[model samples]
Target: MFLLLFVVAFALTVNSHSYHRNKYITSANFFSGTIYSWKSDVVGYFKLKERNNALAEENRRLRSLLAEARDTVPFIALDSTVFPGPYQYYPAKVINNSYSKTKNYLTLRKRIGDPIEADMGVISSKGIVGIVNKVSNKYASVQSILNTNSKINAKLKNSFHFGTLVWDTQEPNEAKLIDIPRQAPVVVGDTIVTDGKSTIFPRGILIGTIKDFNLSNNQDYYDVTVQLFNDMTNLHHVYIIENVEKEAIQEIEDVEVKAPLQNRPTESIEETNQENDAE
Candidate 1:
């Protein structure tokens, strides 16, 4: 009789436990879901800045495309050909940047197939940034304009005179434009821009404005100080410029340079002796 009573009591206890479980299951799930959603909202809030930066980059890309469509030019000589859209700009985030040192450098996050390579020009939305020095499959390093070894071709905006842009390792915002012919009119506060003399930068890209100028030591040129547009100490997003015709132009130049030597008649020993005899 005692065993029968114990079995009956155990069956009643199990049924009671099942009833309580079914009653609380819905509430338990609701609470868990609410907590998860709250955590996700917090995470998203913290990511707003990154999202804004990405949007800004996209806008700049659109502007670049529009500019390309408006400025397409036919092929001409290497330097004279207006590269309209010959350059492809790739947006990259500045993963690391520095300007306090004399030789400042920047690192960007980019992949191998992303159209970036060594010697590519880098620029910000406001103005020039740096040039790509090295690249890996997923990253690139840039040599900042603040470097002592950095030199770029620049010119006065209102005239045809051009000069070489260099840094003095003295100030972050100031750079020197040397070799400008003194004949070219120069005044303080005049605009300076890229001369497009090289394959790196396009003509008229704003570099800076003249802060001061003086006759160079050689007295044949003017040395001008330029105040940069972009703040080198603070950089976030940048564009990497890839010249589509760089390789083709380089190949053509190589052929043209080698053609003269290859076609010139080499002087034989007999010819040399005759020339010496004539002298």
Candidate 2:
């Protein structure tokens, strides 16, 4: 009788567990689904960083192509001992940029020990960005064209009229091209580009389109509002232009500037006395 009772109790316990088997399985499945969802979110978070890096690289490549197209000597082998190119471009990532401030600036990620230096021109695929103002082993700071103190030599894309590009601290998308001759043909859609007057950038590099134009206060020249091609508010990749002959050329130019000042004639003592006597 005790053996029979033990068998009956065992059968009842097994049946009870069997009846609740589906509920137990469902709970386990729910837990597994929650864990899997969390894992997917973690993987996606890491993938976003990879995607950003890839996009930056792609932008650099495209900007390189644009630069090459404008290059007078498009076919250059950098391995050659004597490089004939006046300007060499180095790709950089824009780590930080400021546009809202009156004196905007940009920071680029240049590898440590790179040849980047102050005063180098910076441009994006669309157009000119800024000039390097400071540099370190691993990074460089640029004076944005939108800065109040920033100025660049720019001109009409189809004409020889040139002007000084400056920021009015009004809009990030716009800048002023002042000292342009009023006689120069200008329209709402006329394109502006670098004049190649300075060592910073090559001639014909796109700057922007003329959004509006009016005479200056003195009415001697035109003050044009230019809509930049590159969105100043958003920049990802840029090219740092290194003018290979900058130092040598600057030395020569400096001497030339000082030469005129040093050569000015001094008034002779006798001539001064004669003038005094005449007075």
Candidate 3:
């Protein structure tokens, strides 16, 4: 009998709430809309913390960028600066990245509008990401240094001796800088940086440190393994460098330098006809 009374009371409370809900459901559109509006605002309050966190991260990135600019040398326009050294910058963010495979690449959010083109891209924070291989309106792809095809001119920080930095086909963090003169003191922990010889990256840009070294019996240079500074496995944002002078240099090299003619001239049809007529 006590259980029956409790059940009766619970059913009455549920019925009362159901009647109120039904009344609201049958209410005019304006009344229902107002309630829903309030409900939506309440739901939005639940996501306030997440939204705040994202904003805070973006703000931090901006502040860091400002600090970097202030501390670094000012960026001079190509038209104003002269160079046996030419360098430029095109900032970008890593939208997609991979580093585990033997082949790797990073897709950037920068596009053609940003003055970024093929073979022009250097990471600002991480030193070098890779050259831009392809570009669309709002996207570009980079061939990461970890890829087998990637090569950068690198040198010992302490010595002027230089070499071609390449992959060893074994480790992601390591690469080989072949052709450093055997005289170079390549200890197990020597730091290697981008050689100013190439326009692809800035001089003194950190590449890696000498992880290990071995000299071939007849080789002129030591075989060096470098431990990279940028962990290719996890990268977020990078800066792209666009050498403003690159276009002019390319034009001059393509136009001014002419290959020497063959020792024996191959006769053209018009030349042969002229010779025959003269004969």
**By lDDT, who's the top model here?**
2
- Per-residue CA lDDT of model 2 for 111-158, tens digit only, reads 556698778899987789998876655566777898877889999999
Name the candidate that leads on TM-score. 2
Q: Per lDDT, what order, best first? A: 2, 1, 3
Question: TM-scores across all candidates?
Answer: 0.65, 0.68, 0.61
For model 1, the stretches where C-alpha displacement exceeds 4 angstroms are: 1-84, 256-279
Candidate 2, residue 267: CA error in Å?
16
Candidate 2 vs. true structure, TM-score: 0.68
Candidate 1 pairs with clashing backbones: none
Judged by whole-model lDDT over C-alpha atoms, candidate 3 comes out at 0.67
Candidate 3 regions off by >4 Å? Answer: 1-85, 251-279
lDDT of each: 0.75, 0.78, 0.67
Candidate structures ordered by TM-score, highest first: 2, 1, 3
Q: For residue 90, what is the lDDT in candidate 1?
A: 90
Q: Is candidate 1 or candidate 3 better by TM-score?
A: 1
